[model samples]
Target: MEFLFQILVILLAARLLSEVSERVGMPGILGEILAGLLLGLLIVEETETIASVAELGAIFLLFTAGYKEVHIEDLKASSKKAIVATFFQIAAAFIAGFALGRFFGFDFVESLFLAVAFSPTSIGVVVKTLLDMGYLSSKPGSMMLTSAIFDDIIGIFLLSIVVTVGKYNAFPTATQFMLLLGKLVFFVGIMVILGYRVFPYIFNYVQKMHSKESIFAAVVLIALFSAYFAEIMELDAVIGAFIGGVMLSNVAVAKINDIQSKVSGLAYGILVPIFFAHIGMAVELEALNTLGSFTILVVVLALLGKLIGGFVGARAIGFDSYESFIFGSGVMPRAGVELVVISIGREMGIIGEEIFSAVVLMVVVSIIISPIILKFAIQKDKQKNTSVPAS
Candidate 1:
């Protein structure tokens, strides 16, 4: 009962803060994170539960992103460019992060883990920015989405690798590393192949039932259950849920969209806000204060890494100067999804208190700038044309 009450307070506070931020022309996520921090300071002990619940929000956020953003044709058309740009971003970010961490006196595993965090672009932030800028239908929007999808895949893999390395001091032997890699690959491959084949059949059969409630129940069951199974496979549940959503891409967009809309209402209206509030609860004032300077430096470097990486990577893949900036800016935000990775690192014991505090603060800063960064870059190219959506 106490927990439930805390959740209610958190949700109401977050909603109110979000509204106030919007009224002031600031991004809502910034307000949300700051609210979490203030609450965390006021009620420090609740931060743990907040972290855990927000973790679920992270999963649902990913699933929501995957469900909403992917379009097969755009992906297919831009496959080559997407692949090139994504790899470049991954490599550049990883190396830069690795170097920075080592220079900052982190050990091999710590450096590697931080590097892995740096390497992946935050997909949810990117998509939101794209939608806000009205660029979801434009060429740059398509590229951003494609690169982000690949970024999620690549980032997850890098994180898993870093976790494995952290577990073994000198790095696992080649054979052992490969074996773990194989297990991960097999797990993801089987889920994707089998899931794509099964979900459509299940949805079709459920459709025949002709009951809205039944259909919704079935969808919920599928999404959550798939997420559970993914967790069991030593992968992120959100990844599973996200994949579950994408597999349904072949479904009737209108119907699946309708289902997602409903699912999202429950998710966003109740579950998701609860999750975000939990993120607020988890912020550590003392640790963040201690690491304030370092945290700011990290936020700046991470932002630059994403920006430069997105730009150089996009240009390398044949995008023009303006488009490259779009690619860079599209990936500037770091919020829900990145926090999920940090939570996972915490769970695995790879992220200590200092790192966690820095990440939470970094998230706050990055999210604050995400919209502005995306808008500036976009308008740089289209000042005379229709404005891009900068959601």
Candidate 2:
């Protein structure tokens, strides 16, 4: 009964916060996060459950990301440039993050984890912001979108490598990690080829059941089962969720969108808020106010590595300098994805709670800075495009 009551309070609080935030200019997620912070201040223990829900939020979030309309043609069209841009972006971020982690006295595995954390592009913020700003059809927008997708793929691969190779504070024995990688690769390859047959059949069976709840229920099965498969195999559930979503997304594109809508409602309305609030709850918000100079230095350097790597990568592939800045900024919304990564690491005992807290602080700060920078860069470019003196 207490569990039920806590869940109710979390849902109501998250809804209230989201509604209020949306009425103003901010994203509803900002409100949900703040709501979690409020709960942290008032009822701290509830936060652990909330954190669990946040994990659900992450699963649904990534599923929806892969579910949105995408086709082979779309991938084919952008694959060339995306490849060039993403290669350099991952290489640079990984190297820089690893160096910084070691410099901070972390061992090889920890450094690898840090590198993986820095490596991915957050497509959610960039996509939502672009669509909201009515720039979805613009060339830069498409380019950014394509680059972001490739970064996700690269990020997943890097994360799998990090998790398998850098299990604790040392590197995985090459033989063991390589074997794990082989199973993963085999699973992914088989799914990519066979999902076209299996997922469509499964989805069609669900649709014939003739109930809306059935679709959402099917989504739950997919999420939970896929997540479990990874866990039993000694892999992170988020990786399984991502791979599952991507495989089913293309084959069951229509159902994916419908499932995505319902999933989003749940996440935003309840799960996600609980998750982020737990993050804030775990934090003594005041501690952030007093981080040491050296910690601050590490933070700044990490930020610089991302910004420069993103900008240089984008610029290399024909984006103008300012446009490259926008590209990098768009990728900087670091909250949701990083949370998923950190949670898994903690559960596996690969990282302690203290380090987890520090990483969360890093993500929150980055998330705050990313959108503002992205919006500015885009608006500035739009002004430039429109302000030219014509003959």
Candidate 3:
């Protein structure tokens, strides 16, 4: 009963602030985040139940991102560009973070973990922004989405290295690295094969069931199963949910649209809001009182790392100046994987409280600011496109 009441309060606050945020011409996500911040300040400390629900929110959020916004064909088309962009983006962020840590007197292992924490773009945040702004299928959007996925995959590898260093006080052996790589390849191959060859048939049969919302139930089940599977394989649940969504996307059943509609309702109307709000709630605002300069440096370097790296990669791939800017801005947000990495570090007693707080503050700042810049870039590009006369 107490937990239920807490959820009621959270939902009410999140939804109300979201509407207020939209009215003020900011993204509703910002409002939801603010709501959480306020609630955290006034009453709510992070609880296990709320955190679990928030994780579910992230899973459904990514699932919807994959299902409704990003397409497999688009991912394939942008694969090469995304890989290049991701490499540069992660490299820049990692280097900057490591340098910052070292300058702040952290040891080598701590510096490495700090670098790894700030290195990945938050896919859920990017997807939400793109979906909200109707840019998910655009050229930049496709590139951004693919690049973010690559960032997550790289983050997983980096996390393994950092964990090994933290736990065993040594680098992972080549065999361990190769095993992780093999697992990644196997997971992707199996999921892709199943998505293309099996899911459609399953959904077609599911649609014929007399049970009400059976297709919806089946989708939810698959999403949960995929998320659990990913966890067991040492990958993020969002990745599994996303792959499941992509697989279910191609189902050509009669009520496919309806199924998507239901999923969207559940994801956006409920889970996703909680996810964003939870991010805000998790922010250690008081940490900034002592580490103001450190927090600011983290935020600035984190943004610049992705922006400069993304720009160089996109330009190398032949994107023009403005387009390169869009690509850079699109990849600037950090959440999801970064938070998980820092949390793990803290749990393992490697990351001190002060450092953890600084990173958390940085994540919140990046999440709040990056989307606004991306939106501006997107809108500016639209204006430029419209002003030009057709040949």
Using TM-score as the measure, the top candidate is 2
Whole-structure CA lDDT of model 3: 0.77
C-alpha lDDT score of every prediction, in listed order: 0.71, 0.68, 0.77
Residue ranges of candidate 1 with Cα displaced over 4 Å: 47-52, 122-142, 166-170, 208-212, 253-257, 318-323, 374-391
Model 1's alpha-carbon lDDT is 0.71
On lDDT, the stronger of 1 and 3 is 3
Candidates in descending TM-score order: 2, 1, 3
How far off is residue 353 in model 2, in Å?
Answer: 4.0
Pairs clashing within candidate 2: 36-277
Candidate 1 local lDDT, 1-391, one digit each (tens) = 7677777777777888878977776656666666776776776356456556776677677666666666556566757778888887778767876787787787787777777777776656556556777888787778877777677656656766765676674578989788777867776687678556766677678878866676678767767876888767656677677776666555662246567778788777666776666666666677767877767767777778888888998888778888888888777666666667676676777767766777677677776787788888878878635555652
The lDDT-based order of candidates, best leading, equals 3, 1, 2
Using lDDT, give the best candidate's number. 3
lDDT of 2: 0.68
For candidate 1, what is the TM-score?
0.83
Q: Score every model by TM-score.
A: 0.83, 0.85, 0.78
Q: CA shift at 22, candidate 2, in angstroms? A: 3.3
Query: Residue 314: error of model 1 in Å?
Result: 3.5
